[model samples]
Target chain A: MNEMIRSLENKPGLSTVGGIDCDLHPASPATKTLLPYLEEYWRETFVMRGVDRLSLAMTSSPSRAPINVRSDWKAESGFAGDTLEAVRTQALDPFGTRLAICNVLHGSMIMHSDDMAAALCGAVNEWLAREWLDREPRLRGSIIVSAQNSDLAVAEIEKRAADHRFVQVLILAQNDEPLGRRRYWPIYEAAARNKLPLCIHAGGSNRHAPTATGWPSYFVESYVAQASIFESQLLSLVAEGVFHKVPDLKVVFAESGFTWLPSFFWRADKTWRGVRAETPWLTEQPSDIVKRHVRFTLHPVDAPDQDALARTLEHIDCDDILLFSTDYPHAQFDGLNALPAAFGETLAKKILIDNPLATYPRIAADFQKEVAK
Target chain B: MNQAVLEKEKNAEAKLGIVDCDIHPAFGTPNELAKFLPQRWRDHLADYGQRSANPLVGTLPYPRMTPGNGMRRDAWPPNGGPPASDLAYLQEQLLDPLGIEYGILQPLAAGSSTLNQDLGAAMCAAVNDWQLDKWTGPEPRLKASISVAQEDAAAAIAEIEARIGDRSFVQIAIPPRTIEPAGRRRYWPIYEAAEHYDMPIGMHSAAFGWHTNSGAGWLNFYIEEHYAFSHSLQSVVTSMVFEGVFERFPKLKLIVVEGGFAWAAPLMWRLDKQWERMRSEVPHVKRPPSEYIRENVWFTTQPIEEPENNRHLLDTLRWVGADRLMFSTDYPHWDFDDPRYAFKVPLSPTERQQIFRENAKQVYRLP
Candidate 1:
């Protein structure tokens, strides 16, 4: 598949020195590729069940969608983001990324059985640690957890927390219930304790229709509708007292565009004003809480026009809310123009370096160590 | 007080407020609708009551953002009735005080999108009759929308045809969150009827209760659910454009009441981007989706997306075209937009006149 990902033959103009790319999706390795990492029991079960391969590709980003894989970026035979070489050439090296957080959205968490999900999650982490993190010191990974089982999810986080390479815990924006429900609080507790920011990327388990109504007819409807899901999850996080419960938890919304933030903040605050009594735990306005706790990747910069993009940023008000990302191998923007035009010198430095450092302590600590040396 | 005095009085009133495109007129009680239904269905109503798909019996599945299910706290009738029920209160408190020249009534009754098709039609007919007789007939400033159970196209058309000649009826109100996207051919008869009558379809945000607000699943909070309202409208707009509703009925006009207009610009841009790449899939769509949008659709400006700066709002208005925006108060809702201070942006007199009055006047063909 001759994909249209313009090769990064020349260095991009953006100054990305010591910049932390918040979101770079790595393709899930084939199940057979991960057999060595998995326990023998799980390996035997995979063969017995005839589950040789698994593709947890979300419908929202159908691999065939032009937006999903640019014609130039398409691999000849494998998934586009599978190899680290692609990330190095197309994303990290060109942009001069110091550290790029890898969020591996794979079929592991969506597995039917809880035990299988836990097993696959563990194997995926091991594979991520040994293959990607070890291969490139510039790369760090998100700890994938089987949100299907909270106990196992906590254990997985505990196991990965020891490795400083894991910067955050990965979850999808669309879960069976609101992610803030008490049932999922255990995972949050572990994430906070481990000092891993909870990263909820824009893909769901597909348990329900992507819209409030039933299924959407077109890919565009589903794609556009992702913004609403992000809003819902954000509200759920606030309204359900997730922030109140886990005060230390920081959230990174990768590929969750930031243009809608200002509007959402107003509406959420309005709702909070009216329904304050229902959720007594919410002490501050949603906008204030989101600004303090939430950070978003600057990919698929929803504002297509430069002027509107500038206005959206102005409306966002808080300077620290945006983290930089190339959204590697995904065809959100064309070529070296992965950075939206509005990211001038000051905003660019903050988004690419300062903001990420402030949000992720591990990266900041590592950068400090490098500076001292 | 002859012709000269009357002319002076009219000129004075014309300077008041712009057209209020989103006013909700509620029935004081179930008895209001019962009067118009046949005796048998009336008994059915009394026996079974309005069997909503939502589990909540007397109220909506989720509580609204406002104290009284998203209705304005002050909007509750001074007399013992639901908010927006008293005609005199509406006149004095809203229409008179706001200086509204024409107030479009959007009746969001329990059975507007009822599952029982025939019963739904009957309920809608009752709503229409009640709106005219109780509100529009008395207050000349108030206008009626031919409410319909859109799931049943033939009945909806019949209802539209029944009120087609009445000048008081300006538009056809369809549930925004319908069982199917509003553009399916199954619902084309209603659009055809709207075009035949030269009436624009009015899509206001009301719960159909047929499905959850999102394609995913039920929303847990009213705030989250409220956000889905705009998403629902966007989906309907996309459905209408891509499904060729505009192409099929080119002259058809669409007035999306209550749903904010800020999203229209970006949504259309996204559609045009996609259509450019995927035009072959929908060959019937003769023009770019945005072209159809600009020519056929107008949006109401209540629950306006207030970015921190007023300039952003103005830029959005410009993108969607000032001619495409109609001023709406959402008179009785908690998030109602007051015409005086609703738009934070500074507007030229012409821009104000077009958005507040002229756009709606042209769309509704109001005298």
Candidate 2:
């Protein structure tokens, strides 16, 4: 109710002006074949938001569409109103940035079929180039590299990283092999070389069960289950020495909650000697390495744990490791103001304003210049 | 950003009395446990001979359960004796100047262990009886959470209704796993019975059930699953809230025990946010979802980050309301990390007392 972050009240004049996850959908035939799930209204004007785009919650379940637009639609086809345009008219008025999609990752895209996956990748990139990239000042993208195809992902990263518009390298949190099990370090190395952050977004575990046992009846369980996927990412990258191999490499635990960050560190730090005693070659306290290289977003806020959150931050050694993100338009319903309400002004400032600026070194320059003044 | 301010509070720990909301007897006495069991089951254990007959111990054979992992088979009632050894330990080691003024004694074999339910229930009954006798005194330093036969809800309710008359017994302790949606009705009898009893329900985490865990290879170990296990309790909260269990049981004051509060903030915000659309599904509550949490739910802090930086933890505490949360030592669950190790997060002394003891005294009706 009361904001604690007065410094944040200053709302650091973001000269960089990039959003963490701005999703966009193309308007052409490519978009039709690709982002077939998007309503016509959602298809248009997504590029007008910001540079960084994160998750793609686009679903064909018209039932899932935001309210108010269901009654008013201009469509010639079955349930065929311009949904994107409708979204543009309603929701997009305030926030229409960029959309991040995987080129041809594990499983499928709009559809789980291979053809759909490939088509979705092309469709999103096309939308970026046409609706964003050169056209939209704020449109940014991630080169979706399929965990199923590391080479294609590597190529995608190399290609997209060369263009300033492509920001992150999006990989599904699930991997064909356990993330910490080596073999996957090449993706890290490539992204490290390209100076791009490797963003591991959850919801992609191909040929793998969502839960260790059975599916949870509720969506909340499924969402919370994503923490395991992140545990895998943190372990795979750090324990396997990806960060050590590629020192400059940066990783973001996209959409996965940050509370696990400290717990993972607390556990991972003890692993080599405790749970991981079997593997002695592992070097360094997992916390030291993680706090240095890993960054994650806090969204779909897990209702805050006043002491635990603070304890975790102390355990990890920073107030800024948790980057502020609102998984906007996703079922999570994280608003731009979610941080302010979840945390007080003191924490809201770090999580929302300063943390992001600190995590992405590329943006740190401008923040430094501002602080200098 | 305010390291100095937080440290200044850290230096002022002299005033904070470490409030441990939950602790256990390591394991209870078999003879005491024999009282709650059906004779057929009681006799099966007695056959072990006077020297070997421990009612509280069914002897689970998991080799990984060491002294440090919170299940010290020795600190509990030894397999062949009365729970005499652990009682000395609880008062001497626990109640002495560890700064812990009050401790909530729960069933030791109940949480995150391979301990079976029959024995778990038998032992829980034993624990309740033993604690009632041991913790009642003028300076009454110990408090007990009534242990029910959770697997058998009928007998569990009967057991609760039987001993709940003891004033020191202020809460019904259920392994967090037992506090589920499907199990809600089965346990409702206990909640209803407790309506006149005037005690809060305490839900502590144990090695009871597993929600799907993380990596397959990773899931094999308890270390990896502990993180996943924390989220499982969220399932219990969702069940209670979304299913209108809280609505049906308006007087239900449920406490989420041993559940770390880190992830709760997001889940609360997201769930409350969902009310924007799903409120029709749960029309019983007149206010925001947080109102329900503050009104009906409370959580305990253990393994809490000492120099907690998430700062959000305090914010969440503020959101949940300090009066709703309780401080727990998890006594010997890594030594409950010492309360002073925590509460160093730079809250005012009033905030510290509320988190440490005063808040618990109110929620748990602790002396």
> What does DockQ give for each predicted structure?
0.32, 0.13
Error of 2 at B350 (Å): 4.2
Assess every candidate by TM-score. 0.91, 0.66
Q: What are the per-residue Cα lDDT tens digits for candidate 2 across A275-370?
A: 444334456776777778877776544433344344445545666577655343343332233343324466655655576555554445444666
Residue-level lDDT for A310 in candidate 2:
44
lDDT of 2 by residue, B1-367 (tens): 3443343444455455566787755434335555655686567556742221122344422223345343434334333332323565566556776767777776554511223445555666666766666554433667777777565667677778777777777788775554234224665676676655767877776554333334323343344445445554565676566556667777888888775665455556545554543444456644555567767888887645322244535555655567766777776554254554555456666777687778787877765
Give the poorly placed runs of model 1, Cα more than 4 Å off. A1-13, B1-17, B64-70, B269-290, B307-312
Native A-B contact fraction in model 1: 0.22
The 0-to-1 C-alpha lDDT of every candidate, in the order given, reads: 0.79, 0.53
Listing every candidate in turn, what is its Cα RMSD in Å to the true structure after a full C-alpha superposition? 4.9, 9.3
Model 1 interface RMSD, in angstroms?
4.4
On the 0 to 100 scale, the lDDT of residue B227 in model 2 is 48
